[model samples]
Target: MSSPRASHRGPATMFILVGFPGMEDSHFRLAFPLCFLFMVAVLGNCTVIYIIKVERSLHEPMYLFLCMLAAIDIMIALSTMPKMMAIFWFKSTNIAFDACLVQMFCIHSLSGMESTILLAMAFDRYIAICYPLSHSSILTTPRIAKIGLLAIIRGAALMGPLPIFIKRLPFCRSNILSHSYCLHQDVMKLACASIKVNVIYGLVVIIFAIGLDSLLISLSYFFILKAALGLTQEARVKALGTCISHICAVFLFYVPFIGLSMVHRFGKTHGSNIHTVMANVHLLVPPVLNPLVYGVKTKQIRHRMLRAFCRMKSC
Candidate 1:
């Protein structure tokens, strides 16, 4: 699956992954923190997912959306963490070209999935807070299922062609990537062939997908806020309370996503350090913090976790 440093004489079948630019001497030391974060992300998300699955009381629309979010976080971590850590710990930087493409697709597609699910979560919150009586009926199991299915399809359809586009181009330039993991933009940047199509399509996907989704999410919150403003002080606080966790999650995911996308699109002159750090945050922070945010911010999850731990301790 690995090969020697590829030459630029012909098409590249192997590429070098630069774990962290300007940190060659301290990669081993740096790997520790990253590995710890990876483990926490995996375990935290898994715990949240399992808790939701086994607790019948937590099977409401809000909890269901949280579960889906946790699962997506797990997938996002799995997609990039292993190979990234391998590069850091074992110094295995050579990645097969095809495998790199798969990683790229998974990262972007899953990001799209997270963005769509966040939009859906915002809608769920909107219904629950603004139209409490219809919340249950509106976000029924079948409807949630359809949203999930649509998210999957949209992510795939938008990002699936990226790898094919990259494959069609010939990579005769440098094969060194600036980040620890494979990325669509990073991969295509190495291609000696023209990438006008890739650029346009990439922008279209970003604009229509996450960009539109964020705008809609904002609109949903605008309506939710409008409805909440009509309520009494205590009632308004209670209504907005239910949305706090989701709001935190949306910021965590979108802020980094938008920042990284902008860096890729327009930060060409920026230092590689900024790009690398931004990329790591975009890939790592949401998975690490999303479940934690939900776990701490949502009372039901917090109580359930407390009770579960108390039982484990025979308290």
Candidate 2:
């Protein structure tokens, strides 16, 4: 009989998931779509970054946040999509134990960074729309840069312990991860040892860090909306237009995230597949849609991208 550590039957059984049981054929189905999505994500985010870097007119707090967001999106895609596509296409899902922990850490760290950056953006928007005269003084270039650095540091510090904790867990069983990538919860389940501490810490981080950030973002928007309502029709329309893309992005990030958490907590067994799909969407949707949403909504970015594309073609 094969030891539990040696069996590759379930993701919970192997150090790395070689493949899924019934989903072998489904891998082929996902290959082209995943590849196409990955390319689009990378190209779209790079375009945003390029536009910010090249366009001198975009050197304000808003565009700075946009640049930070683009960078984060690139990191997000880099962390997860490459491995996922490799798994789908080449069936190379055998990530080493240490590597799996690293991947999970990177994924969650970038995700936390993205959320923090979004909150910063919300505050920037709030100041701009709610107190336009003071916005420039309050959100200078140096201050914005500092905020970006702070975002990075906060994310790294918050998620830095996850991999350490995971590494300390005894892998009495072989570590196979369900789904494509090494998510924290899935990876933790592979440990035959007690995971109450891990789970508790994870929830605490989620509640205090992500939850607090999200709540503050919502409050910022609430005040922003109230201020917008007081403006003239044209100003209100302009303000609404300016924020619509961000509002969409925020909703895209949080709604599914909260739903996934609730499902995990309350409807675990019955909603397993639903939870999985939502979790995957939570990871994929923001990176894929962020650039597109901002590009279409922000005229400056769109114009800069078009000019950049034309220049590239002419060369």
Candidate 3:
């Protein structure tokens, strides 16, 4: 039998954000390192977006998709990091119910958008490498715009129902979330009522939306590999070289994801700190690393980023 719920509805209540369970005293120490990561994420992603926006030479499909990725990375960082820092630094754990839902929506939807952008990037590389002569005609500016629009819409539509479903649950059990920010799964776990709908819905979204995206990205890369194999060794190296940054970006995002999923499903004895560390790795590492990887690997972006830095120093 379920324990008696608190006699209040959930909407008006404030939920608590736990920075790290059993490690509350470590929050201040944790904040310093995490703050550095967040700063790098924000600055790196912003530089990528700014460089792409202003550089007409980077108006191609691949770079445009990269711009979308950078933007989504910034959004994800903004949605979670500030609140996380507040929790760690100021002990600001209480979040209004509505505000929590808003944060959840932003985090999940932006993650979905990021996943879609990654897939779009894979497709762009496939087209560029496999159908080099037709690349320009195939991925015109109009088509690229449409592709970006679809990513935004897909994210919004899929994650839109999450908050609504979560809102219907009675949250009388406990308000303490497992992480520093609001997540749909974390919030739903606090509810006294049945969360069957929310669980099934979240699973469906993860499978069809995020999961399918990764699958498609892999398929795109498979074709790209085949195309690359047909070329001479020198030509193959050049073609694959163009995808190095993207491959690194993909690994940064998904490898941690796979690791976290494994820990969640199989390592039940693991402490909450383990989960917290893994979750943050999945959530935070890509935003901090993708810009660096791309800027280092792509010569055009490297030159432009260096130029931008030189101008800033002169000012």
Give each model a TM-score: 0.96, 0.91, 0.93
Q: Which segments of model 3 are wrong by more than 4 Å?
A: 1-12, 265-270, 311-315
Model 1, residue 26: what's the lDDT?
93
- Tens-digit lDDT string for candidate 2 (1-315): 232354433323235553344567888778788778878888999988888888889888888898899888888888888887788788777777777778788888888888898899899899999989999999998899999999899988989999888877766565555567777777787776788988998998899888999999989989998999899999999987888888888888888788877776686573146656766787888888999999998999988878878999999
Candidate 1 ranges beyond 4 A from true positions: 1-10
- lDDT value for model 1: 0.88
Query: 59-116 in candidate 1: lDDT tens per residue?
Result: 8888887888888899999999988889889998988888998999999999999899
- Which tens-of-lDDT digit does each residue in 237-285 have in candidate 3? 9999999999998889878877776765575353647767787888899
TM-score of 1: 0.96
Candidate 1 local Cα displacement, residue 95, angstroms:
0.5
State which candidate has the highest lDDT. Answer: 1
Q: Among these predicted structures, which one has the highest TM-score?
A: 1
In order, candidate lDDTs are 0.88, 0.81, 0.86
Separate clash counts for every candidate: 0, 7, 0
How many clashes in candidate 2? Answer: 7
Query: Over all chains combined, what TM-score does candidate 3 have?
Result: 0.93
